[model samples]
Structure formats: structure tokens, C-alpha cells
Target: MMLSHYLIVSGILFSIGFLGVLLRKNTLVVLMSLELMLNAVNLLFVAFSRYNLSLDGSIFVFFSITVAAAEVAVGLAIVVALFRLKQTVFVDAFNEMKN
Candidate 1:
């Protein structure tokens, strides 16, 4: 596969994730969308690494994956806590943070 092919796929994935984040009302779906976007970036990093025959991009991807995993963990924890508090996972339902 060519670099352009990888880039095109990454762009499509990013666009889908962006749309999901903007249009989805559910917190869990939004989080998943965010993860999708992160993965798209990771794909780009790996692709460039391969194209350039370098290890730096791959190293960056490793860190990106680590950070993404941490993000998912924290995001899910927040979502679960919010659900327990309000019994709902809709983004709009979280407009007010005060008791």
C-alpha cells in the first residue's frame, strides 16, 4: 500500500470520529469516537514511520497508545460515576455540574 492510501484511510477515520463526537448525544459513544480519532492519529504515525524507514514515529505511536489507554480509563470512570449520580449517560444531561 502507498502512503496516500494510509493517509486517506486515516483522514476518513478522523472525519467519522469528528462527526460522531459532534453529533452523538451519548457520553460513551462520544468517548469511543474520541478513541477512534486517537487511533486514526496513531495509524498516521505508524504509516509515516514505515514510509520514512524511521523508528521515531513508531515511538511516538507507542506513547500515543499509552496515553489513549489512560484517557479511556479515566473517561469511562467519569462516565460511570456520572451515570450513577444522574442515571443517564446523555451529554446534555451533564450540562450542570452543581448539585
Candidate 2:
């Protein structure tokens, strides 16, 4: 696919992920949206790397994936802790921590 095509796809995926994050009430869905957004970014990076015929963007994508993996690990830990304390996966239930 061309760079523009990849960019469009990435944009759409990012928007969908943004909507999911904003509209979903469940904590798990929110986390998944974040992952989707990350993947979209990775796609964009790879596409640009191919377009430029350079390893820079691809190398960054690799680092991004690694960071994303770490993010998932920590995010899931927080989610598990929240579920244990609240007994529900709803985002609203986490509001008490705002203080």
C-alpha cells in the first residue's frame, strides 16, 4: 500500500480507538482502546519507514512496541488491583482515587 493509504488507515483506527476510549464505560475496553491507538501509531511508523527507505522509523516502531508491552503489563496490574478493590471493571468505579 502507498504511504497515504497507510496514513488514512492509521487515522481511522486512531479515531475509532479514541471514540472507544471516550465512550466506553468498562475499564477493559478503555485499556484495549489504548492498545489500538498504539498499534495504529506503529503502523504509521512502519509505513513511513518503508516510504523513506530508512531504518529509523522501523527502529522507533520496535521501541514503541517494547514500551507498549511494558505499558500493558503495568496497565493490567492496575486493572487487576482496581477489580480486586472495587469488584467491578467499570471506569466510574475508579473515580474515588481522584482525591
Candidate 3:
């Protein structure tokens, strides 16, 4: 496939994820959407790396994957904690966390 094909796919994935994040009220769904967005970016990076014959994009993808993993771990931990405290996973329910 061409670079434009990869970019188009990435754009679609990112837009879907962005809409999910914007419209979903559930924290878990939002997290999954965030992961989708991250994966879209990774896909773009890999595509660029393949077309350009450079190691830098792959290296960046490795770090991005690491960071995404850490983000999921911490995000899920927070979700679990919030669920334990409030018995719900809705984002609006987290407003009390300020206290």
C-alpha cells in the first residue's frame, strides 16, 4: 500500500478514538479510545519507518509503546481505585476526586 493509504487509515483511527474520548462518559471506554489513538500513531510511525528506510521511527515507536503500556497500567489502576471508592466508572463521578 502507499504512504497515503497508511496515513488515511491512521487518520480514521485517530478520529474515531478522538470522538470516543470526547463523547464517552465511561472512563474505561475513554482509556481504550486513548489506546486506539496511540496505536494509530504507532501505525503511522511504522509506516514511515518502512517507507523511509530509517531506524529512528522504529526507535520512537518502541518508546511510544513503552509509554503507552505505562499509561494503561497507571490509568487502569486509577480506574480501579475510582471504582472501589465510588462504585462507578463514569468520568463525571470523578468530580469528587478533587477533595
Candidate 4:
């Protein structure tokens, strides 16, 4: 119920997401981790907004969710295309994309 609680949880979520993005090789896991990180930021915005007694944070979260939805759609499509081309979801497999 306290601001500290929200901050701690948000920090944990962000850390986990950051590690997942850094240590995982799977593209899907990386994408999910990115989502986790984004959600953590959203939680912080909401907590601060509530603490400040304003609706701005919630409104920002709404738009953030909308953008995240669009990102997932496009990201998944790209992943699907990559899989079709390479037969694997591991990030390392796409190194040839540089060429």
C-alpha cells in the first residue's frame, strides 16, 4: 500500500526483465522481457501519478498499453517471418540479417 512497496516491486520486475533480455538467446523471450520492462515503468508511472493525485499517469498507461499492443503485433509478425526463414527463434541465428 505504500509508495516504497510499489517501487520495490517495479524495480524487481525491471531487473528480471533486463536480465531476461540480456541473458536469454530466444527472440520470443527477449520480446517478453521487453514487455515486462515496459510494464514495470508503467507501474511506476501509475504509482507516482496516484501519489500526486492526478489522472495523468493512468491516461499515459492507457496509451502505453495501446502502443505496446501495436508493437507486439508487428514484433510477432517479424518473428514469424524470421522463423519461416531460419527455422529457429534464437537471436543468434539472425546474425545474417546484417548482410
Q: Please list the Cα RMSD from the true structure of every candidate, rounded to 1 decimal place.
A: 1.7, 1.1, 1.5, 1.1
Per-residue C-alpha lDDT of model 1 across residues 1-99, encoded as one tens digit per residue: 889999999999999999999999999999999999999999999999999999999999989999999999999999999999999999999988566
Clashing pairs in 4: none
Q: Model 2 over residues 1-99: C-alpha lDDT tens digits? A: 568999999999999999999999998899999999999999999999999999999999989999999999999999999899989999888888599
Off by over 4 Å in 3: 97-99
Instruction: Provide TM-scores for the models.
Output: 0.94, 0.94, 0.93, 0.94
> Which digits, one per residue and each the tens of the lDDT, describe model 4 over residues 3-51?
9999999999999999999999999999999999999999999999999
| Local distance difference test, candidate 3 | 0.95
Residue ranges of candidate 2 with Cα displaced over 4 Å? none
lDDT for 11 (candidate 3): 92
On TM-score, the stronger of 1 and 3 is: 1
Any idea how many clashes model 3 has? 0
In model 1, the runs with Cα more than 4 Å from the true position are 97-99
